[model samples]
Target: MSGNSAERAGELEVVLVKAGRTKIRYRSELLLDDGNHVAVRAPWAGEGVRDFGFVRFEPGDVFTEHYWRDRWYAVKEVRAGDGTLKGWYCDVTRPAVRDGAELVVEDLDLDLWRSADGTEVLRLDEDEFAESGLAERDPEGATAAVAALDELEKQARAEGGLTALLA
Candidate 1:
């Protein structure tokens, strides 16, 4: 179904899981479909001391995740329970798949994070991604993943940045 229809119907449920554990799940009221990318926002599920690269969540967090069908990267904006913006977390992953009730991403173990104001960029988990054997198995994909992180960082510093892209 098109994103507009999914948004109007309020039936788009996205579940994000990694390594057999669910990281987050939410029902989205608006889904943006821009040919190759889809974006959705909702309050994060559960409560924990969740850590992005440059920030941490106490108990509650709301997030907007933007997924690209062709790119191996997804950008997520983290916010506090009170709706205070925190930062951006970008995940290098396999292209997302959208099923009837879910959207799945196979995270590639590499991530990028920047503070709320586009300062302090961190590239995280490089060792993990290397140890995961993804590079040996798919060298081209690994290269693309790194390139995606670079491009994401560039976007984070752009005039409109991710917020405009999501909007």
Candidate 2:
């Protein structure tokens, strides 16, 4: 559970869904699956370097992603090919669902980013979240998404930050 030495259960197809459509689907090495929480390792799924000023996700970046079946968020720890810690990327989403070899998660358009040194903790896509009209369409879901984002941001700012949570 702490390392990648755990039994490898082949691969899992991670499906990111938004607005009732699949936004991205990538295969990841299933590292840990404890019924409630699941962890996987995968390379950057983006085509090229996606520089966002704060961070860049390139082809050689590796992502150790964690998803919870009960939590409304997913946390991904990004590292370079040489094993340099980049940071953590969190997605506010509905609880993940596992069906056979597929893991499905619905994005709520809210995300959080934390720098490796913990100097930068950014709450992103609030405007997109608001403009998504999820509040009007699904009030409960919207509320949950907002709450999840807040929780993640708070955790990312804490003393040990996401490191403690992920550990």
Candidate 3:
């Protein structure tokens, strides 16, 4: 999974190991690949990023990422690793790609966080995404990406919305 080789795209599992620890803690499935970037869907562990401190992994903190090539943003469902619902985290970025046997996402830095109950929604890293000049490069796609986030947030707040998709 580490060579400069490309495979005939199909179903694949991307193992996410803890930064320092060697054991695999998560697996994201790549659902599709169209010679460009592969689409991955999976539950990701959530650790606070803004505070700039050590991130402690909780027992049941997970976010389900729904990634696709047609959309510029990937919508995710935040939940406990044990399946307790939390909220949503959206990342605005270029479509994912399959690097060797692994799926790679170059996160564009902009993100949106919404509480599980739909009460709090925060758009993160606006400055960074803007600084990257993605909007200037492709204004329409950038705007549509943000719109996709809005739509995903609304759907995530509904009962059985995100989890069903994950299933």
What shift in Å separates residue 102 of candidate 3 from its native position after superposition?
A: 2.2
Alpha-carbon local distance difference test for all models: 0.76, 0.92, 0.55
Name model 1 segments beyond 4 Å from true.
1-9, 15-30, 51-53, 158-160, 164-167
Clashing pairs in 2: none
Segments of candidate 2 deviating more than 4 angstroms: 1-9
Q: Please name the candidate that would achieve the greatest lDDT relative to the true structure.
A: 2
Q: In model 1, which residue pairs have backbone atoms overlapping below 3 Å?
A: none
Residues 98-134, candidate 3, lDDT per residue (tens digit)? 4466654446566777666666666677787667676
Better of 2 and 3 by lDDT: 2
lDDT of 3 at 126: 74
Candidate with top TM-score is 2
Ranking by TM-score: 2, 1, 3
Model 1 has an lDDT value of 0.76
